[model samples]
Target: MPKNALGAAGPAVLALVLGLWGITREDSMWRDEAATWMAAGRSPAGLRHLLDHADVVHGCYYLLMHGLFEVFGPGLVTLRLPSVLATACAAAATAATGRRLAGPWAGLLAGTAFVLMPSTQRYAQEGRSYALVVAAVAVATWLLVTLAQDRPAARAATWRWVGYAGAMLVAALLNWFSLLALLAHAVTVLRAGRLGAGRLPRHWATAAAVVVTGALPLVLVSRAQARQVAWIPPLTWATAPAPLCLLGTGLLCGLLLRRRPGAPARTAAPAVSVVWAGLPLLAVPVLALLAASLIKPLYIDRYVLYANVGLGLLLGAALAVVVRSWRPFTALFLAASAALLPLHLGLRTPQSRVDDVLAPADAVARVSRAGDGVLFIPSLRRDTAEVSPQLFAGLDDVALVRSPADSGTLRGVEAAPARIREAMLAERRILVVGDPEDHPGGPGDATKRRVLAAFFVRCADAETRGRRVQVYERGTSCSSTPARRL
Candidate 1:
């Protein structure tokens, strides 16, 4: 195969193989993915209602997966396959971008770097829109590069402009934060002197305007649902360094590549352009989010995950420059593979997740009998049950008034305080799933703990990763039931 084809094909194959290696591990789904599964499981109308009330930004992705589920049926492999495929496309597109800007060697290196990055491997095997966003941004960037190189007098420039517009539109729809990529593209155009009185600027402006117009409604709706990001804490100086280091490393690598021995003298300019093409994409989104976070906490690293594509390209170019001969390049690749062996193995284990819902689910399944009652302290621990509904299928949720699917919400609705107390008093053997620290807090949580203390005996308490399971038996041995409030 030609070097050009190898540049694209090699990275794609690596990404696919890496993505599928542990695609169906026994690890339980985290809350965000559980939310994806929950949203995708809903009927079209129910999902639409869910978007109107919450998580409007993810509406497009959920709808896409909903259609996929209709054919494949819901499972971990099916849930994550789209992300894996999208990551492969992103790897191919990254290679093409590097090939366009520099040479086939740079393309191959950049594509390999993309597949090797820990973040790339992490999200590629998980069900989410970030991988798709990365792919769309990469393809759009490649098209923009093509537009920049085209002769102004050529008739083909118009079609290229239309394609760029469509790609940008798809990217923005996937994740609203992807719109930040336009700022990066704008920097590239300005640096290339394409923003003046020329066809390039005119076409570029028209495409950007259309994308913003089309995305306006989603922006408005998602803003109304801003509570969805309330978990994001205010930014501090600590949050600034990691992204700065990443962007700085990419720029530094590009500089090193530009000055490398045996590199073509004429290639200096393209190396600079590679840095310009990538730096803004890596920096602008992070800076914008940091600024916004001063007002309301909106910054999170994964929100701008596509910026890593630029880092991968710059790193690839640097690698190509340092290892000018194929022998050293091969050695470097082999060394990286050996070093990543441990991380690769760890990714397949349940310990990799924020919380392993499976361990707690399995614990509950082992002890609980038919007709046993289940309760979630602080209510949100219900996410465990959502992840493995089959394990929880036999236990009745004593406090749940509406199922997540029925309520069209991420966490199901809870019954009123009176109904919860009544239900708790009636159960003979109740199993409570919660974090240990979530005890005896808030109106509902306090009420549930108080009722359990007053009317039950602690039979067993088991601690799993990030969760606690306690079994309570009906008895007076714990504490006397307090007088009921009318």
Candidate 2:
């Protein structure tokens, strides 16, 4: 009700969010987190080399976290804190914008939703760019609204344009996926008079420049990336459902809230905001389905968290609109969120699919020696093996040794099969964990059988919650070559 109370509560909500996200997630970092940690180690120059050449992640977020870790303590907390803070900042920004659009009460409501919304809370805990990207997109939208408010005096208008342009630039730097946010913004504003006439033309010109600058790196990298184009099929529709759900629900809620009576704004402005936030989340799935029809490989959900923010904010707003004076509504929201606390603290948190070992990982962690090198043989199942780094922490090295070339330290990428054989040549003791994919036991599948056979004379099998672990010792009986025993 009061300005003082809203301002005070903003940080409190943010603190509650950060507390939930940060303190408990220290036990396990998911696959994408591992990927970020792995990427954070690259020299800034090395990252530039990777980015100037290979830009799927768009290079900027990794490089920023790389610097943050240098200052923060190079631990899980350090890797994750920036993102946690970013999510909070995004929530705070959403509140500020809500305050601008509606009033302090509305701002507080929206901000609270941004922080406490389950999906937002879940991602804020992760060591990835989604949280930071969420914040940036929020800030960019806020700035867009500021521009649309149109303080036409030269200085204010110029400043609004500057803030708008700068926020767009930073958002692009954070996540290329935010490109969808930018496209959505451009579309909504244009449809309204927000970007109409001379203003619209200039805005388009500036936006075109911003997009070109942002996409230049991607276009260049995508060229040489033809070698990896085979992996692009994962972008298809059959596999696109998760992202669609992520973005669509968020957009739907935001639109629903933004359009409600007493929503404290004209329909057109909030409509534009909803459209801005929703389009990319909406389009990527469509594109993925198209790609899936054409090819068939590469789809995932975590990054879709960026699209979820608008939804979360809108959902919060919708809840506020409906339950304005209802204690039960507030209690229901708080109670449902609070109930997730135990899972959040436990290693069993749902994101563990990306963060830790399911059953098989626990099996290996339990039975295998720290010195045992575990290989998820089929390799490249990033989520399934998401728990590997955490399980092997200070214990063993895990790799996708699809081949011999992966022996020694090749980071986490799959190594050539021959290189692995050569690297393990001298080890008097070796343990190989085989993947089921390598042994489908089908026609003309002797090569797969031979690889498995060569690695084991004895198969020691173990089982954990969701996975099966089988250990193999070298044996001559299964191979014509009579491989040496350890």
Candidate 3:
């Protein structure tokens, strides 16, 4: 294979292997992915209603997944395969961009490093829009590099700009956080302008404007649903370490360049371009979000996952500097893989996520009897049963007023507190599905627990995979009714 092909194909193939290794996580699905599965299974009207009410930012991704589910049917593979393919494409784009700015060796290494990163492996198997957003941004970044270096005139340049804009628009539609990539690209374009790439910066501005304009409506609508991000914690010393570690590693790799980024020497120009491109992409988006988070607390490492491509490029460039021989490079890569083996293995397990959304079903099956009333504290735990409705088949959902699809919401709408109390009182036996014992549930959950405690006594309790299933019998005292086996 040609060096360019090797650079692009090697990392892509590796990404696929890693992504597919445990794509199903032994047939487990977490809550976030459960959200995707439920949304994708909805009818067009239901999906439109969902957008009107919540998750408008994920509207495009949900629709795309809906199409895939329509054809493939909603299995774990169908739900997660697109993310794997998107991650592979992102690895290819990252390699191509590094190759354009540095060389084939650097590009290949960068791509390899990206595939090995834990974040890439984690999201590559998730059924979400983040991986797709990364792919779009990586492709757009590669196109920007081509335009800067080739400096193609007239039609060719126009076509590249068009591709760039389209790629960026797709990313923005998938997740508006991806728009941060343009900030990194703008720095790259300014560097190109400094290097006498006339008209390129102006062309980039036009392409960026088009992308922003196209995604403006989504931006406005998603903003209206701002409560969707209400769970994101405020930035503080606790949240500072992760991004700092990532940015610190990138800086360390950059030091390996051992040259001024603005060097004007003909042979050193590529190195300068690589540094300018990779460093900004590595630093800017993360820093911008961190600064913004100080005001509103929106910083999440996953939100800026595309920045890992920049780190990969820098690591590749640094590795290329020392590992002139393929044998040494292979040895070093193998050593790094060995060090990450445990983490990679962990990513494929059901325990990797916060909670296995399907795990509660087994416990529910064990404790529930025909006609028993089921109630989910905090409501969203309804996802646990939704993904495995068969196990919950005989149980009555006592508080649900409307299904998620019927309500146009992620979680089904529940009855008012008074109505919920009235409904629960009618049941002789009720099953309480809740988060882990340590979880401090919201006021609504507290109210539900208080109501349950007033009339029902716990007969049995079981916790598995981050969920708690408690069997309750009517009567404040459990002394009369024997405690049931778990």
Candidate 4:
């Protein structure tokens, strides 16, 4: 392959190999990914109904995955394959963007940096939309670079601008937060003096307008469903470090590139263009979210995952400069590989997630007898059972009013507090799955725990990664006190 072709292909190959390494591990799905399975595994009409109730932001992605599930089945590999492929696309697009702005050396380094990013690898092996959004952002950035370097009178330029618009539309649809990239693009346009002076700016603006217009319906519906992210805490000084660190890292790398031998003579991209392509895309979103967070907390690192592409581009350029000699470059590559060894091993373990619901699920399967009852404290922990249905197959969810499929909901509907209490009384043995000793005070959960405490005695308890599994026997209570009714 030509050097440029090799540069573009290398990152993609690396991402695929790394992504597949742990794609089908025994690790249990986390709550969010379980939600993906639940949403995507549903019928189209059911998924639509579920979205209308909650998770509207993920509607498009769920629909896309629903089709994939139909063709491929919902095994772990199938669930995560879309993300893996998307990340591979992102790797290639990052390389192409770097090649356009700088040179093949910069492209090769940038693409490699993207593949090696911890966050990139993390999401690439999980079943989620972040990788897809990252891919869209990267392709959009590449298209923007192409458009910027093209003459307005050229027919190819118009087509490239249209492609940019379509990429933006896909990005916005995948995750509404991705539309934030447009603000970065706006800054680039202004910096380049393309606004109002050229056909490119007008076309860019028109494309942006179309994206916004197309996304309006989803934006309105998803905003009304904003309670989905209600768990995000208000921003503070503590929250400032992550974005600052990212921005600082990119800028520091850019500065280091200046120390290269005859740095100005070997330049692949102009300093101004690099700043235009990189700084705004990386900074504007973080700053915008920081500003928005003053009113309501919306800042989360994964929301701006695409910004990592800018950081990778900047870092690649610096690395290219610093390791100008082949011997030093080889040494650096070997050192990075060694450093990543432990991380790669860690990613394959079940304990890598917030909670290895798999361990708890396995424990429940072992202890619970046929016809035993199951309860998920805080309700959402039902995802544990949902993800490993076969392991929990024989046990009945005593508190479940409707199955996830029947209810068209992510976690399924719980019975009324009184009904749940009644159901718990009838079971001889019950399995409880939840966070360890951190019960959220809710009426249904309180009623279930109260009934268990009053009527049953704990038989066994096992702790998993971030959850607990407990078995209780109805007649084992030492207390003679009567169980209270709700």
Candidate 5:
């Protein structure tokens, strides 16, 4: 392999190894991954119907996973392997970008840093579009660097621009938030010295326009489904800390990348360019999203995961300058690894995520009896049953008017409040599955709570991390009921 290829390959291999270390998480799947599975498992017509109503933002990723599942069959490996491969691709692209702006050592270190970051590692193991978006952005950024640095023939430059545009379009299709990466690239161009002089600005603008044009339809369609993100909490002071910490780290890394007094002009130019590119790529998109969130609350850290590439570039370059030798670098790497060992280990556990969909399924299976009715307090907890349908097969979902696949919605449309009440009252015993706190504020959930409180009594219950399963008997007394653990 060529020297550049070797630099890229090392980090890519490292990412793959880390990503696949405990890829299955002991056969556990969380709500998000379950959502992916449910969507990907749907028939083509069903998936298309789903996109027409909701989750159009994830439509491209769902389609891709659907194709993969059709070929490989659905399992933990099939669900998560794409993310692992995408992370490897992202690491390689990060390394290539670093190599273009700094030295080969800088590229290698940057890729390693990217692969190890907690957020990167978390998303790398997840079955989602974020990893793929990161890969696309990294490759686009590298292409941007190549375009700026090399004054290739017009035809060659146009092809590179086409590739950049295509990469950006892919990122946008995966998740529109990734379009923010272009803003970072624009900042890099505006900061360029010799690189930004001449036709570069015009070419960059043209390619960017192409990207926007290609992604315009998704942009518009997903905008109509904006309510899908209504659950994201508004920006607050607590959310300020993570972005502040990242800014502080980026600032420190930027200071380290500053030129020394005797540094050669050729080297100084590249260092300046790297900082110009890296800082904006690291900070602009996140800060922009946060600023936007002040008005409408769309900020989510995972949205701009591509920024990690910029982080990798700066940190790797800083390490290359400060460590000076492989021995010290290796020692530092080992020390950092030792510090993060517990976190790395914990990330592979079933309890790592917010909630395990299977946990609730297990709870339901233990507490439910044949012909018993099941109710999801907010209706969304139906996802637990969706994930492990076999476990719930014996119970009747009394509140559900239609299945998720049949309704062309995620949780499926629930019956009216009165109908749900009538249905629950008819059941001899009912199972309620939801979060521990019973505040589903929706009308259907409110009605279920009221009816259960007035008519039925809690007979047996099982509580797991982030979920609760309760059996409510028709009568007021539960004297003969036994406590259960799930």
Candidate 6:
């Protein structure tokens, strides 16, 4: 291939990436993302306060983004650029891996497949580390495969291993659970018997040493923070682990896993195949079981995004091996995946839908005219990312009740009855949510039921994909007089 041709692949694909990124830019932040922004925005001292009192599972990611916001500033675009850049680089990396192991066709298909997976595109569009983690995972895995396959070790292989180790370390720093992917990679390498037995032990010892040395402090800190954390429930076939994993994996890697190679590497077909099919399948269950024992039961699909690229490349590899003459069918498959890109962006990319966890604006629209006075029930704030901003920061009138946050329309309420009454009286209409009744006082689920029904008139009732948000109007009192004007 001409050097110019190789160079063309990058910018050619980058154009598509730049365009696709624009389409997913306005996606509303889900609960975790919103909280991430809020937490990272706090001053260094305030962040320390948050770590001691709030979720510390990803304090490093928070700190990194804090630095990022210093350079790029905040809001949806500034926040999500990392994921977008990570995914775009992953696409380029996928192409390079393919071109290295197979050929130009393989590289193109692999990159295309990467951008098409609903999950890949979805995470790429979010303001979190999942996309970056997955990209690092792919780049690292490719380097590891390059290392293992070297009959006569080249500088490339050493650089690849060095890169792989560094990538794994960065991923661990961003989100520790990503260690599961690296662990699975190690296991797959072990199971394949590729690294001579003695070499294998040495290789693993280094990996273990790195993971323990790097991740140990974060793990210890997380233990202390767990006391204040809520219990994450177990996974089911449906939603425990993200449902996207099953569907995306099936669409992307299922065929490649079971298929036998009919053709040779277009560029190392055999070993790369092992990394593709095995790591993700092993990583998911391994993490689930391990987490069940030590941490609160939990599974989030985005955590394993590195596996998605492996699947995409394998999918590319399978096509390369099997579809020797079926050019038209290959075109069709690629086109269909590309065509679905908009749908994924529209609904899944930002994790959006009619029934998304309440939009921050919904909380804003309610309190916009209340002289910017926003009062949010802290209990409800815990429910989703929109909790703090949408509920209170919709405008300048934001206040926190049942919360330690000082800058708000109301304060020191402690979910107290007198306080709820006071914020309601001071603001136009207090938009209480989640367990509305339980905060101030209640016998059970019905605790705040009567009060909400009695005073707050139902303005809107709606549900989508199971997330439900109801708007209520408090009957006109002197407190609500200004709201009527709104």
lDDT of all the models against the reference? Answer: 0.80, 0.55, 0.85, 0.80, 0.85, 0.56
Residue lDDT tens for model 3, 1-486: 137699999999999999999889987898999999888988889899988998999999999999999998989999999999999999999888877766777788889889999999999999999999999988998888887777677999888899999999999999998889899988988888887888888888999999999999999988999998999999878779988998998888777675532212223334236777888898999999999988887998888999988998888777766666445776867798899989999999989998888878888887678999998977999998778889999789998999888889988988877788788889999988888763666555666788777888889887777788888998876644566646
TM-score of each: 0.91, 0.72, 0.94, 0.92, 0.94, 0.75
Mark the 10 consecutive residues where model 3 has the least summed lDDT. 260-269
Better of 3 and 4 by TM-score: 3
Model 3 Cα shift for residue 480 (angstroms): 11
Tens digits of per-residue lDDT, candidate 4, 19-101, equal 89878657567767888988887889999889878888888999999999999887788889899999999999988777666
lDDT of 6 at 105: 60
lDDT of 6 by residue, 18-57 (tens): 5355543444556556666776677776666667665676
Candidate 5 lDDT, 1-486, residue by residue in tens: 137778899999999999999999977888889899999999999999999999999999999999999999999899999999999999999888777777777788888888989999999999999999999999999888877767578899989989999999999999989989999999887766455346777888888998898888999989999998999999888888997788779878988788531112223334236687788999999999998998999989999898898888888777777666345776877699679878989999888888778877887877678999999977878888987899998888998889999999889999999999999999988888988786747888889999999999888777775788888888778747554544
Backbone clash pairs for candidate 3 read none
Candidate 2 residue-wise lDDT, 386-460, digit = tens: 434476554333334432112211133554555455444433233443343344522223332355566555446
Model 3 residue runs over 4 Å out of place are 258-272, 325-330, 438-444, 476-485
Model 6: per-residue Cα lDDT at residue 93: 71
Q: Candidate 6: where are CA atoms >4 Å away?
A: 1-20, 23-27, 151-160, 195-201, 227-231, 237-263, 266-296, 348-374, 377-413, 417-486
Error of 2 at 236 (Å): 8.6
Candidate 6 similarity to native, TM-score: 0.75
Q: How close is candidate 2 to the true structure, as a TM-score?
A: 0.72
Error of 2 at 360 (Å): 9.1
Error of 2 at 386 (Å): 14
